[model samples]
Target: MRRTDVAEAWLGVGTAALMTALAPLAGATLAGNVGAQLLRDQQGWHRTTAVLTENAAYTETAVAAGDTGRAEAMVRWTAPDHSVRTAMALVPTGTRAGATTAVWTDAAGRLRHQPMTAHQAEVLGDLAGACAAAGVCLVLVGGRRVVVRVVLDRYRARAWERAWAEVEPRWTHRHA
Candidate 1:
């Protein structure tokens, strides 16, 4: 073949090979993204359930306190099964008047003395209110508790939108 003809043939062959190789790569990437999305969805569902369970625990504590017509209090932990287990005792009415009360519990559920700050207590009270209003739970460990109401139904669509934005560019480049 002439030089120009041979060059054209080589270019066409390279284009065909690239296209063939890219097709399977695109398919594999799509499958991976789908699998990742499924896993994310499952995790989001589990988190939502956990939040709901925690909210219930907060409500229970509030109700128990309210029923006694005094400032009753209890501390609970979220179990692995998404259930709240009471970890501390209920302080009855007419106890000491303090801005913050700290009740520490050991791994064996034994009560230990803790000194909580007023700010921490106020934040917990706000979280409790938010949980009761939103029907979701909030658990604070060392700092202020802030509940943003990130329910699965409320944020799932946004999460999927974000996931798509992350995946789409890769997908377009692969296909192109």
Candidate 2:
């Protein structure tokens, strides 16, 4: 009968509504940040279709996920300034010298890592927001359960004590 609710009724409704609304809002904010980062990355970066200039110097097998095999090799690409540039790039193992690969570059035509696409950013952001919302909900529910359990246990303990007191006198008198 004692109120041991972790959150008031209005507070629970408010939290639920806020979480529902903030999920999309957080996703949107994260998406915007992704876009800003991509823009910053693009400032000095460009993509070039380049060809390997020599046979794979050596093949490397990575034990890590998504990075199983790689061949380090030199590649040639024409810069935006109409100059030919050669840079070291990673390619599939056993690649022939003339195999073509996509290379990202900076304003100075230096090789740079590829940037994530807009779709990837959006998807990642949405997933993050959903996970955060779920975590919040889980914490709220778990807290409420713990509080309710403690309150109920206390009430049950009081009832058990009262019942035992009534039976204890008769048992003691019989023994005497």
Best candidate according to lDDT: 2
In model 2, the runs with Cα more than 4 Å from the true position are 5-14, 48-53, 57-71, 76-88, 92-95, 98-102, 108-110, 135-176
| Residue 50 shift from truth in candidate 2, angstroms | 5.5
Over all chains combined, what TM-score does candidate 1 have?
0.24
lDDT per residue (tens digit) for residues 30-49 in model 1:
54555454444333222111
Q: Write the per-residue lDDT of candidate 2 for residues 84-134, one digit (tens) a residue.
A: 999888777677888898888888777887767777766765666566656
RMSD of 1: 24.4
Q: What lDDT does model 2 reach?
A: 0.70
lDDT of each: 0.42, 0.70
Task: Give the residue spans of candidate 1 off by over 4 A.
Answer: 46-176
What does each candidate score in C-alpha RMSD?
24.4, 6.2
What does the lDDT read for residue 111 in candidate 2?
84
lDDT of 1: 0.42
